[model samples]
Target: MTAEVDAYLSALPDDQRAALSDLRARLQILLPDHHEVMSYAMPGFRQPGPKGKMVVGYAAFARHLGLYPHSGTVIPLIDCAPFKTSKSGVLFTPDRPLPDALLSQIIATRQAELAAGYGKR
Candidate 1:
């Protein structure tokens, strides 16, 4: 974990920090091994393939937690009606953490995008 990421999480209120921490743990477990770093001023993971790319990223905000798959292509690929979503990511609250199935789908879709050379820039 990067110091910036630690500081970011550490600065959050306990509930937010805990929620983000849980999300971080889930990402780490689901994605392949990678450098867990601070990217886009947020907690993110970068996989070491095809020139060490960023596979996914996430952050916590005042009202919700944000999960970024790092690709616009992934936004519409998954069904996220249960949560709020935008072109870049999904938003959910701490009290209502994202479901395991949805998380897997997001990560899977991101992985497919990477494998397909879709999100590389």
Candidate 2:
């Protein structure tokens, strides 16, 4: 993980820190070729190379935590039923962390989008 991301997670509450750290570990394993980055002030992974797009991002909030797929359409394509979802992200909590299978689906969908050259600026 990047130092910036480490600092960010270190500053969060114990529960939030633990949850995100777990999520971060899962992401790292899933995206071994991606680069860890602090984008939009949140911790996330980006595709390799200098101009690679952001694959996914995550953040902590007062009442909940969020996993951002960085695309307006990604969340809709996946099953995020129990957790609250928006156009760009899924709202979850430390008490009820996102399921491992669901997180895998999210990463897969985002990677597919990147491969297709979607969500490009």
Candidate with top lDDT is 2
Name model 1 segments beyond 4 Å from true. none
Candidate 2 residues lying further than 4 Å off, grouped into runs, are none
62, model 2: CA deviation in Å? Answer: 0.1
Candidate No. with top TM-score: 2
Q: Could you tell me the lDDT of residue 120 within candidate 1?
A: 55
- What tens digits encode model 1's per-residue C-alpha lDDT throughout 1-121? 6788889999999998999999988888896578888888888998875577788899887788899988887978888988999998999988998999999999888888778887457
TM-score of 1: 0.92
- The root-mean-square deviation over C-alpha atoms between each candidate and the true structure, in angstroms, is 1.5, 1.0
Cα lDDT listed for each candidate: 0.86, 0.94
Q: For each candidate, how many residue pairs have backbone atoms clashing (under 3 Å)? A: 0, 0
lDDT of 2 at 81: 93
- lDDT per residue for candidate 2 within 42-92, as digits (tens), equals 999999998989989999999999999889999999889989999999999
